[model samples]
Target: MKFLHIADLHIGKRVNEFNMIEDQKYILEQLISVIESEKPKGIIIAGDVYDKSQPSGEAVELFDDFLTKLVSLAEFVFIISGNHDSPERLSFGSRILKKSGLYIAGVFDGKMNKITLKDEYGPLHVYLLPFVKPAVVRAYYDEEIESYNDAVNVIISNEKISMDERNILVAHQFVTSGGVSPERSDSENISLGGLDNVDASLFRNFDYVALGHIHRPQKIGRDEIRYAGSPLKYSFSEARHHKSVTVLEIKEKGNVKIDLIPLLPLRDLREIKGPINELIKIGKEDYKGSTDYIHATITDEDEIYDALGKLRQVYPNIMILDFDNKRSRSNISFEELSSEKIESKSPLDLFEEFYEAQNNKKLSEEEIKIIERLLEKAGGIEI
Candidate 1:
């Protein structure tokens, strides 16, 4: 039994802060081509099937077409919803879809519903673990599950899984110190301490563990337990990482072999850092593939006028711009800055505190009122 592993598809994703619909279409086409050529027995989409809870019509259509192609092979397809997905929307008609070899695990109903797929040798049991909040999981199980780690353990322990079966577990969440991409920073709500950590031993009994939530594809601890990253470059930070899916060949129940198939991009991700004159003159240099997607940082004393237009000739997908050289250079430590504890008080009390702290200059009535509203929205009293 062989299968293709892909995740964080984010089908309706409008990345780089730009609505690049055409680029998305091109990448999806490339992915379909891979499926056609590989012809795996099953395909596992780890999580984040769609970019939004209410995805646009085009996104739904694109996903439907993609599934239609996959359905032709009638391969076992397993999916789980991420934080971005609306469980109700994603799981709609999921039961019926399962009849066609498709399974969507959205809501955490406290049952480890295994989609058993029979191969030439024996049965393969795959567990679909969708993104779940600790509160929800605790309520469903009727327990005090304070953290994601706690909730997962409770689920695993209570799940009616057989030790005799060859199991596969799929999950989506931050696995303690797993790789973080800039794209994820925007989409994922960072629940660092309590909600972030999950032990790899949770899936010890499984033959293979397919993971999601992390954008850059990488093996967490080893090759067997891995993340088949997003199909396309979702962030400038992921500029250097090669996006790809993992193809697994399981000849027997417990044995597994893995292969990483590199994905082709409509525009490659790239970053360049230098002075204004140097970046402007990058076209003159022998930069071959840098034109695809560019994140240029100008390290100059002054802002370069129309910097993007100048670089667009050589780099078409230049979406982000930064000025490390020209902008304010403060070397203050984040830890120290964030550690300053302020007291919750009235608007006037807040003004007195900030006024004395910044420059020992007191604020006027009008200034105080304006600053009060701003700080109120920014959680000034919540210090």
Candidate 2:
């Protein structure tokens, strides 16, 4: 059995305040075209179908259209909701869709969904465990779920899966092996520290583990366990990532071959570090791909007049601008800065620091007010 592994579509996502709907549409079309050529038996969408839990109307339409086309290309399709999705909403008509060769696994109601496919060899079980939290699992199982590994192990143990046969597990979590986490991008909204880490050893029984949550495509511990990565470069931090879809060919139990089909984006994300004047003088012939989205780091010792304006004259889609002079580099380390800020900063300042780290810019006054209201509601703190 052959299948296409993809994840983290993040439709309706915005980068540097620019909407990516058109770019997403273009990439999805390319994906569908590839699907038509490869003609895999099925497609496994690990998680993070949309950018937000309550996706916008346009996002809903975009996903709906994609699914409509996908079901026509592949016979069996499996999808699970990620932390960014509302499970109930994603699985609204899951029962009805399953009849049409689409299996949707959203909420975890104390059980994991398993669908068995077959070839000439034997049965191939495909287990779907959507993005899970310790608290959610504890509520259902009523057990001591102290860590992510514990939660997952307990859930799979209840399923009574036979390890003798070939099994493919689809999961979305921060999977780590020997204290080493997978590569992360700025677009992924993960918890700080190691609160969400799940040991990869918990999934040793499975033949191929299709993982999500991390945007950089890589194998964890072994080649069989992999992250397909996002179809596009969502952040400047992922500028070096060669985005692709993982194609798996499972001939028999414990016998699998993997291939990564590269995905080329409509506009690439690029970073250039130099003086503003040098960047402005870059001719079209000198830089063939100047139209790509740019993150420029100006290295001039003194501040140039309207530096961004000058660079924009040459590169229209400049997304990020920063100074990399002596003054900028002579800053304290992140550990020291975070420690001092925690001791001296107010709640708002702390929140702004976190926001700026996730996003590349500080929150606006309106956005800050929204955060204040949410904090007040969650913790009953008067800000």
Candidate 3:
């Protein structure tokens, strides 16, 4: 059976105060096109259906339309809620939806949600395990679940899993191998000090483990255990990530083929560094993607007037503007000033030193004249 594995939809997400509704809509349309071409038997959305617990009305409507299209194209559709979602809100009408081959497992009720599908190889079991914390699992079972690893281990142990049959587990959690953490992005809400990590060894009983909660697509321990990653790059740290949809074709037990189909975003996120004038010239001449989201770093030695305004003329979608000049890279400390030294120095001399230290350059003759006039008016010094 062939199935497409996707996760971290993060619908209704915003990047750098820019609404991503249109980009998300466009990407979902491309995903639907892929589904039509592949004709997969099922679609497994691991987790993170929404960016927030309380999503906007438009986000809900868009997801509703996407789900409707998905069910029509595939034989079955499985969805699980991630940490960002409200389980009760996501599971609404799930019982009724299951009748139409759309199964949602948002809330964990002390038992794993299992769905059996038949193919040429026989029966395949797919388990949906939503994002769970140690506290949530501890309340259901009397096991000593102190950490995420212990919680997941206890839950999987309780399930009557048969290694003889082809079994796939869909989950949303931080899985690690040999204490090595998966690649993370700024958009994810990670626990401090790695408290939420679950060992990948606990999933040895399953043929394929589809994971979520990590924004970068990668495998934890083996090829079958992997994270589908987010369909779009949510942070500048993930600017280089090539987002893709994970396609898995499972035959008999221990036999699975994995393929990654790339996804193209509406507006790619990029970073560029140069002087303001040079950057503007490059944007007009050689840069083809002026509308792409950008984080620009100005490396000019002297301060430029209206830097952001100048860049915006060429790159309207610029998200961040920074300076990497000597002033910005300076390590000057003001704590070295002593009371005696401060009292000995004239106010004008102190002001000049302070300005030079702050700007990494001496004040110009015109600026010095302006400051002297102001000081004279205030009767601080005679000029």
Candidate 4:
């Protein structure tokens, strides 16, 4: 059984205020070209189909087109909802869609959604496990669910799968190997504490575990257990990632081979740093050629007049502008300032400190009265 594994499409994503629907469309078309050439039996999209729970009309339309193309090419297309998706919204027409070989697991429903497919070897049971939380599992199961690992283990224990046949698990989760965490990017919304992380050992029984949620492509513990990563670089922190889709070929119980097919984007995310004049020289080398989304840091000691306007003349697609001079570098660390001194200060003293930090001046009497009125309205203080 051969299948294409992809995840974290984030269809409606906007990076640095630039809409990526066109870029997403381009990449989806490229994936369709791959599907046509490879002719895989199925495609598995682990999760995070849209950037937001409520996506735009354009995003819905774009995904509809992609699904329409995939439905025609592959026999099965499996999808599940991530933390970013609204389960009800994602599973609206899923019952009808599944009849046509498009299977979607949006809500957990206290059971694993299993679908068995046939190959030359035998039956391959594919289980779709949507992104889960402790609260969601506690509503149905009587077991103690304190963390993500507990929730997953309880669910798996309930679903008794026969180990004789080849089985695959499609999951969207923050999975960890031992105590090590997966490579993360600034764009991903990771939760605090280790409560959300599940151990990779819990999935050792499956023939292949297709994972999502982490934006970097990597193996959790073994070769069969992996994350396909996001199709595009969502943030400048991920500029080093070579985005790709994972293709898996499973022959039988213990036989599996994987390959990564690279994905080229319309505009690459990059960071460029140097003096303002030198940056302009490099930016102006080709007015029409260098269209990469850039985060440039100007290192000039003296303040230049209209720095952004001057840089815009050469680099039209500059997304972020920052100064690497003394002022920016001289910012105090958070640990150096403490809440120990805060307990003694009055509310007005705290306000004055904040005002001085922001504007380099204390609040005037009139401004203080305005703040007092706002605080009174909020029930924080009396006049």
Predicted structure with the largest TM-score when compared to the true one:
3
lDDT of each: 0.76, 0.88, 0.92, 0.89
Candidate 3 deviation (Cα RMSD): 3.2
Quote each prediction's TM-score. 0.79, 0.84, 0.91, 0.86
Per-residue CA lDDT of model 1 for 1-383, tens digit only, reads 78899998888877667665567788878878888888998888888888899999988888888888777864678889888788889899999998888999988787656888776777778889998778778777776687777888888888777777678888887764343322343344566545566767666777888988878878766567887888887777677778887999887766789999998887777788888677767645745665566788877765557877877766666778776741234332223344234223454564565555443346787887787688778876532
Query: What would the per-residue lDDT of candidate 3 be over residues 1-383, giving only the tens digit for each residue?
Result: 99999999999999999898898999999999999999999999999999999999989989999999999999999999999999999999999999999999999998789999999999999999999999999999987989999999999999999888999999999999989889899999899988799999999999999999999999998999999999998899998999999999999878899999999998889898998888998889855577888999999999889999999889988999999988877765456788888778777778888887788889999998899889988976754
Model 1, position 171: C-alpha lDDT score: 89
The sequence of per-residue lDDT tens digits that candidate 4 reaches over residues 1-383 is 89999999999999989898988999999999999988999999999999999999999999999999999999999999998888889998999998999999999999989999998999999999999998999998999999999999999988878889999999999999998888999999899987899999999679999998999899988889999999999999998999999999999789999999999988788788999989889877866445878788999877689998998888777889998876566544334557877666667667766666544457888999888888778877633
Clashing pairs in 2: none
Ranked by TM-score from best down, the candidates are 3, 4, 2, 1
Give me the overall lDDT of model 2: 0.88
TM-score of 4: 0.86
Sort all candidates by lDDT, best to worst.
3, 4, 2, 1
Model 1 per-residue lDDT at 177? 35
Work out how many backbone clashes candidate 4 has. Answer: 0
